[model samples]
Target: MARLELKSVRKSFGSTAVIHGIDLVVEDGSFTVFVGPSGCGKSTLLRMIAGLEEVSSGEVHLDGIRCDHLLPSARGMAMVFQSYALYPHMNIHENLRFGLVCQKTPKAEIEPRIQRAAEILQISHLLDRKPSQLSGGQSQRVAIGRAIVKQPKAFLFDEPLSNLDAELRVKMRGEIVALHQRLKATMVYVTHDQVEAMTMADTIVVLRNGRIEQVGSPAELYARPVNQFVAGFLGSPQMNMLAGLGLQSSEDRFSVSADGGRLRLQLARRAEATTGDLRCTLGIRPEHLALSERGALRVTVTGREFLGSETIVSGTLQSGESIRASLRGAVEVALGESVAFEMDLDHLHVFDQDGAALDEVDNALPVDSRQDEVRQASPHHR
Candidate 1:
């Protein structure tokens, strides 16, 4: 496996600049995922790494060797695309061997590589099957197998699971993670789905408007985002952002008036640089909110979605700001009912009008133990 680095990477179409100057490193044998919404340049950045797209201005390095000038075939990287991209007329075995054949590999050396790939992908039984005769998941396995046979220094995946059904997607995600572990090869994956990035990546790169917003492990980005956009973009149901007026700090406590002073929250003194009045935003995740009799915020129930094990309730604050809460079980709240909600104070986030995260509270909030469990279970975790 090889380490990949991008230094001041940039891209543009004429005068319209896309990827800004971006600097990042993909550690050897690590699974790095590039994630963002559409038009955010995630796909463009991945293509640049694979030599599928030219870099406007930057250096692409593999194991400390500059390779931006290399052709796609000379990069020693195997790419797996979203579309299966299998040759329709070729059987699975022939499809897996096509690349090696084109390279003029010794005939004796090629069959063993193809056989090993098919066996590892568990598609040995389907060696003779054509692309049209296989299921979507099977076809994807063959596509991945094709990459495996190449024995490249790294693998690049461009939303390889996006075309599968929900259940199949989940199944394929596990398979890919397992494949990464078994191979211990560096992989770069591109997807717009945060869930995919969260579950599969050792390191996640959050991009916006062609610039890198944040780069961290799933837990780091989730528990402590560097900005409002990073906070809102990584979570499901999204974080609730309420416009607030930061009040003066009193000793070790700080206060903020949100929802036009109808809601007030006291926080542990954090941002020592800002002691006086400031305009800011209060952020709390849905799962970190709960219904309570002595809650400081009042919300009027709007709707509820019961999803077997948990209930997602949407509401509006006194100032008409929308809010959502994820409760443990079925919640019995009627429409238009006013309810008081409490937040997990330690987990709250504060962002200035500029959207940058303020200095964290002294002593800091403890990382959630559940997050540790996830990392421990991930195959990519060192």
Candidate 2:
């Protein structure tokens, strides 16, 4: 196993600096994912780590040894790219053994390695076929199998599933997890998909503009995101952000007001909120809103989507803000109908104008209990 660390890592092309000084560590045998949107420098950073791109400054260290200046082949790492990139002319068996041939590995050892990789990827029967005959998913598997044959200390995958269809991607996700368990090798995966990051990573690095936003387990980032960007970026359907809302402090808890002190909802005390009026923004996830006759706000249903086990309702709130409510199982609601929705006080998240959370333990029940309640409702990576 290898522990990868980048200290003050910076990359620049000409005078344009793409990667800001970055400091990160990937522990031995852990799966770490770098995730963000396009132009976020995720792929550039990955290439830098792979030694495919020259670093302008700082150092890349693996297992306590500096290797920023080493060639890609000298680094004990294997990479799987978005394209399968197989030698189309070669059969699967020959393609799988090509790397070993280039390295001048013994003929006896090459066949065993090929056999092992094909068996592990369950592509033994297809070994005699060419890449042209394989499906997209199967071709990608062959590509991954090539990396597996290398048996490197660490594996780097750059959007390896982007080419596959949704169902194939899901199947490959499970396969990658199983492979990780079987080998327990260190892995650094890059993707623009939060769902992939949430599902695959032991540690997630959320990056933007070549800088690291937050690094944490899926549960930590999901439960207590450091800022608004992270809170919005990590969730599906996104978090409902009440941008023009005002805050009113009660004796114990706080209430959110719209249109100058109109009670929209009561909120749990923030662990960092004060007694005075604060310029406040509120965030409530779609899954946190419950449909109720006694709901605090009524929304005009604009659309409804029934997704097997759950239903999502999109509507316009009384404040003229868009809101979506996700309820477990099916929901009985119609378009153009008025529906009432409520959020548990404990589930309300208060953000300041700068997009930071507030509520300094305005002490009602022990804040830990409510925090635990938040934890209970939170979806954690298994």
Candidate 3:
């Protein structure tokens, strides 16, 4: 395994700066994921680490050795690309052995390495099959197997499952995670999918506009985002954002009137950031809103999607702001009917006008505890 570090790493293409100064460390044997929207420089950062792209400034270190100046082949890392770059003419075994052969590995040693990799990946029976004869999943496994046979210090995956269908993507996610656990190797993965980053990473590095936004475990980022951008980006169905103006305050709580005074909220004051009447954004996730007749927020149901295990209801608040609620089980609500849903006070996220989180969470909510449990049970857990 290897410990990788980037010290004020930067990248620029002519006059356009793509990667800002980024200082990060990938702990030895940890699964680290770099995730963000497109053009966020995640792939560029990964390529820099792999020596496929040069750093404009700063240094890259591997196991305390400066490697930014080294060639990719000399960096002791294996990379699996989004497109499985297997040779069409080569069989599975030949593809797996290609790298070792190029390095002038002994003839006796190459066959043993190939055999071990194929067996571990459960592709021993398909070793004689050409790349064109295999399914997408099978081809991906061969690509990974090629990397595994190298036995490098660390592995790098650049959206390795992007080409698969939805169901296959889900299945391949589990397989790769299992592979990480079995090998216990250091890995750096780049993806635009937050779900993949949340599920697979021991540490998730969130980037925005070529700059680092937040770096933490999935649970930490989910339960306590540092800013509105991070909060809105990580969750599925996204958090519902409401423009509100603070009206009153107390020693440990405050009241905010949202939706042109149609919706009122009395939230616990976790920080001393907001004092007077200030305009801010109130964020509530879909799952945190429950259907209640006596709820404070009134909404008109616009649409409903019954997802078997849960129901996702889309509605418009009295202020004309669109909101969604994820209610448990099947909920039969008529369209255009006015419904009220209560927000889970403990799970609320408040952001300042500048999109910065204003709360320093003290009281732990049930959902937060559940996220903690998930983090603890994760195979990537430290």
Question: Mind sharing the TM-score for model 3?
Answer: 0.93
TM-score for model 2?
0.90
- Tens digits of lDDT, candidate 3, 22-110: 99999999999999999999999999999999999999999889999999999989999999999999988889888998978888999
lDDT of each candidate versus the true structure: 0.87, 0.82, 0.87
lDDT of 1 by residue, 1-382 (tens): 4999999999999999999999999999999999999999999999999999999999999977888999999998999999999999999888988999997889998999998998899999999989999999999999999899989999999999999999999999999999999999999999999999999999999999999999999999999899999999999889999998877677676667787776666667766645778899989999999877656667788998888778888999878899999888777777887777777877888898899988774432322431232211110101
Overall local distance difference test of candidate 2:
0.82
- lDDT score, candidate 3, position 76: 89
Query: With candidate 2 superimposed using the best TM-score fit, by how many Å does residue 123's alpha carbon deviate from the native?
Result: 0.8
Candidate 1, poorest ten consecutive residues by summed lDDT = 373-382
Candidate 2 local lDDT, 291-376, one digit each (tens): 76546556788998889788888998666888988888877677888767666556566677787767432222222322221211
Worst 10 residues of 3 by lDDT: 373-382
Whole-model lDDT, model 1: 0.87
TM-score of each: 0.93, 0.90, 0.93
